[model samples]
Target: MKQYELNTIPDEGYRQALASLLYQLADDDFILAYRGSEWLGLAPHIEEDVAFSSINQDTMGHASMIYELLASLGEGTEDELAHGRPPEERRNAIILEEVNGPGDYLIEPRYDWAFAVVRHYFYTVAKKVRMDSLKQSSYGPLAEAAVKINTELYYHLLHWQTWFTQLMNAGGEAKQRMEDAVSRVCDDFLGVLTLGPDGESMSRYGLIEEEAILASRWTEALKKPFDSTGVQHPPVIRSLRGDGRKGEHTGDLTDALHTLSEVYRLEASGTW
Candidate 1:
């Protein structure tokens, strides 16, 4: 086994669970950041575009950190692991890897602001829960990474929550659109909360807290703002699409994987 800069040895089970958790974290950020990258020059407003780009960059950086940890575990070098992988090899949630809207980013991209807000807001909340738990991870590297990642996430949560609330209250067309987005998001959110077949094992080994607790905390975090709006926000945790952590996903991820790896794939063996 490859050694890391940190010398803590969690049990074999804990180590394996930690690796699994890292993959989910890295993949989630990678795919969503890619989606956010697609929105780079196409946001409805310029200021929002700048703010959004910062978030995407932050997410990509976080993914890099996770990928580095994975590399330390002998998964592969970070560059090859990220650039040389095929779409089916990816493990990101389906919702995240989906396109911004009906059209492609290269052409007439009518991206939906509402969908972006809801999906990002919900995912951010879930990430906060997971990171909080990881702060107590038995593995020293993971706990340390959680501490660093938690700092950047503060801005992400605030930004997405602001957009979610503002858009929901924007009235008429905006409200309708947000509602539709909410419905779609609720349908597919199971992907984010899932921790794969080893979820229980992960919790038991202190890689993270129980999945139920994490999911509940996420719901509790969202409840306050949702209640204040007087909207019919359902409290149930729903995941219409199958869990991605278990290797189940939609074609959206396949397309995203192709694009993100495009530049890197051109010369994966060459140092850039």
Candidate 2:
């Protein structure tokens, strides 16, 4: 297959498939980064709070870079793509868009640190799997983007893995919390691994690997860590909330979009 730069994509079908994949990539990081930003000043401790913020910033920057790539493909301006779309148009996995927990982030926030650790670790593992595959994408720009994104993912995986393992081994309440968090995350984690309805076309076009392959890689990567933490890996992963790739989303995404897009919406015509 011939590699395609943004302007050199020859077939309309290929262009659409590339756009779809880019949306999935851009929206996943964008929503998750927003969720991460909400945890600012709310982490259990100061050092973690700072470290976590840095990760969030990096994730958001990754999202911005993807959005810019989309813009070059004529999707829209980066700001418009990131903020102008409604929840139904988002392509992020439903699991990523879910709220951190009950209660508002600004008031009476009851954010669960255990849940955060488990979710981040699991999601980062999946992201790494996808990025590794994307490094060989037929789309030249995306392959380049994936290489850059993969560099930061190392720290993301390490940071979350450390938190996940430590909390799981702490015993007593911490252990119980971490285990419960693992179960909760498992309920929706399959959505994170899914590549949506166009997954086959994406694979056929060499945009990325098949969903099953990516899922297998993610599971293999997580096994040692899960075993060490005494957490049982779920035999089957389910997308209980619905697939975000197909544009089916939950209320969590609605709330998140409203917050993240607020500034952009306030002055849509004005420069940021």
Candidate 3:
């Protein structure tokens, strides 16, 4: 398979598809990392606060790396790509951009731990599947990024999986909360499973595998945890209309970007 270097990509169609894919990848991590950052000092305990902070930093770094790749492709400077995009231009999954819970991150945040664990766990598994396939991507930079990302993902997946399993087996209100979280996650989870409108071209160009194949892998990967914890597979809602890939987003994303970009917006001309 031919590996496409920065300028070696074959045609206009391939560039557009690859750029779309890059935006999706970058925006997903960028938005979710921002969400994760909200847990700082608010995690269940001090240890988790520290550990979760580290994880959020790593995730945001990954987003930055991808933004640089996009910059190489002439999209914009990495800062602009990361901080300048509007809600409609963001390509993250709808689930990733949703609020961590209700209320503000500051001043009496009634965030739900169950939702955080479930969302991160499920998203991590899906990301692992995607990254695994991306390791073989024909786009050299993306494949390279996938390889580097898998290192942190190893710890990330372990962390979330442990939280997920332990919570589900707690067998009380904890278990019930986790199950409810699973249902809510499943509602928009499909957003992460598909590659959006560019899915066909992405596969054709060998950027990554098709959505069906990736989704199948995600399902299979979750079987072990589900089986061990005796949690049945929650039905994934396929009718979700707020698919973020197509720029369909709720006010959640608007509010998130507002907060996230506040500092960057203050100094748009500054470097990252």
Candidate 4:
């Protein structure tokens, strides 16, 4: 029931909580999208390559939307927030910040397709869960942004869900690889579900559903596929690496930021 617009938020504490949440949302999508793009020519097939590229584009656009909302609240311009921040200042979940697989994209690049599919599928589902709750967020701009972003999620979810389920059902090496990837993803999955220290105020302010509620919803959503696929249900997700909401990150994020900001830093401003 509590609702607020861009500049109409009731207090600085609320703004801080809102900013923290927005940064998490924006940073998660931004980095994940970049990882998706790395699969540009490396996907299983040409059609899928195109489809994945489009999905990453949409995901990056969603990040831009939230970054703009943050800028409206005096955080910084969208580009600056996307490109200027150091790794420790980022708020994305550690799992989402993880690289697709070993080897550089342009080098020998021994990437793991199973890991890429698993990671994207899990992250996309989490994004959907949050977007559903955010549609009724206390902040007006954020709620509206959620409404806009939610429309594209159906296709995103379907795409990943299909990939996840099909691979799990295939059996043999495909199934084994997916199982390994699932375990790896589950290890740090809690990073995706947590709301960090500001969680209490964020929930109390009605910005979005509480972290536990949203986490429960995400677990429930995955039940259908996990049940049908025969993969052992990972009941409890934990963050073995670190909690990214608190700005704790691995070297993967540091390297990612370097690559992500290289072009932006070269051309800091628009020119004719």
Candidate 5:
């Protein structure tokens, strides 16, 4: 059987654990992509808006694949799984849900491009590390999915890293803005790194690599370019807000969920 091939019912404990990991992956990408979609047509520039949308689409596509995996496991229909779930049930990090800035997407957004770049770039790198680890996961289907997902991430990582490097080296108001944005993103980065309460079990089962190892690798991967450009890397990253893997979230997620699921919610019980 193909590595990415669907399984009817996983009788083994490893398969069940794999399913849970996949759910977390799907949920995280779904929520974050929804936030990214909100930024559409509202970015600082036209070029950036186009580039940003591509990344959002890629993320949503990844989420869709995960949802399909869940569907195969009889979790629920993909549409229902995505749109019908309440905020408290969401598993995305609080940082992914945070508002772009002080205003609605339809209004004068007053969004911060610096924050967007920092958050997306950092998240992309962190995700790359995680995905690389997953490519070697014990679960065959997930390992295959990781290999496939990692293919598109090359562009996503480059796109954000370019923005991060350029802005940090811009040497003016841009640098100050980016610096401030970095501080804000780091405050909640741990939320993205956490693998929930079952992290140890996941690692023990070889479902995914150790979180600390992944986090350190992420730090190292980001540090080289940052050091070359003289951008200061934070001594340590902490989730000052809270952990999202534990189902803790923020108001931003509440608003974003409403927007993304609006049409879906209109006919929650009906097929769209």
Candidate 6:
């Protein structure tokens, strides 16, 4: 697999496809990390809180790398791309932007720990599948970035999977919460699996595998864990809300953008 540097990708279609893929990767992590940041001092335990924050930091760092790659390809500065982009411009999945729970994080945040665990667990597993395929990306820098990002995902996967398994086996309020969380997460989980409308172009250019293949691999990987919990996998994983890849999103993303870009928007031209 010969790798392609930014300057080497001469074809307009290939460049567009690669840039599209990069935006999807960048937005996914950026929004998810912001959501995770809302849980900083709000995790169940102190140790878990610290560990989860680290994962959030790592995820954000991954977003930064992808943004920088985009900058190299003549996209705006990373800060502009990360902070200045409107909700309609964001390529992240709708599931990632959803509020942690009912109330706002700063106010009476009755955040659901079970949903956090299940969402992160399911997302991390899917991420792993995606990253594995990305290692073979036609774009060299992206493939290399995938390799580096993958190094941190092991711990992320272990941490969430542990929580997921424990909560599933606890048998009581915990079991019920986790089960309910799984059902809720599944409702929007398929959005994370989709590669947007340009996904076929990405696949044709070897940016990543097709959406169906990635979804199948993710499902197969989770079968054992799901079986342990005694819940059969859903027959169809549909994007109930809307497709984020196509720039369609819910109000949740608008709220998240305001929260995340607050500081950046204030000093866009000033040095940090």
When 1 and 5 are scored with TM-score, the better candidate is 1
TM-score of each: 0.92, 0.95, 0.96, 0.96, 0.90, 0.96
- Give the higher-TM-score candidate: 1 or 6: 6
- Candidate 5, residues 118-219: lDDT per residue as tens digits? 888988998899899998876677787889999999999999899999989999999999888888888888888888877877787787988889888988
TM-score of 6: 0.96
**lDDT values, one for every candidate:** 0.82, 0.87, 0.90, 0.90, 0.81, 0.89
Task: Supply every candidate's count of residue pairs whose N, Cα or C atoms clash at under 3 angstroms.
Answer: 1, 0, 0, 0, 0, 0
Residue lDDT tens for model 2, 128-231: 99999999999999999999999999999999989988888889999998888887888888878888888888999999999999999998998888788777
Candidate 5 off by > 4 Å: 1-16, 102-108, 269-272
Q: Candidate 3, after superposition: displacement of residue 59 in Å?
A: 0.3
Look at candidate 3 and give me any clashing residue pairs. Answer: none
Clashing pairs in 5: none
RMSD of each: 2.9, 1.6, 1.6, 1.7, 2.7, 1.6
Candidate 3 lDDT tens digits, 1-272: 88898778899999999999999999999999999998888899999999999999999999999999999999999999988989999999999988888676446657899999999998899999989999999999899999999999999999999999999999999999998998888888889988999999999999999999999999988988898879886356462657888999988889888888898999998887
Residue 2 miss distance in model 6 (angstroms): 3.6
- The true-versus-predicted C-alpha distance at residue 247 of model 1, in Å, is 1.5
Give the per-residue lDDT digits (tens) of candidate 1, residues 1-272.
22223456546776677778888999999889988888888887899899999999999999999999998988888887777766666677778877887566546657888898889999999999999988888677888999999999999999999998888778899989988888888877877888878899888777788988998898889987798766875555576777778777777777666776777778777752
How far out, in Å, is residue 223 in model 3?
0.5
lDDT of 2 at 209: 94
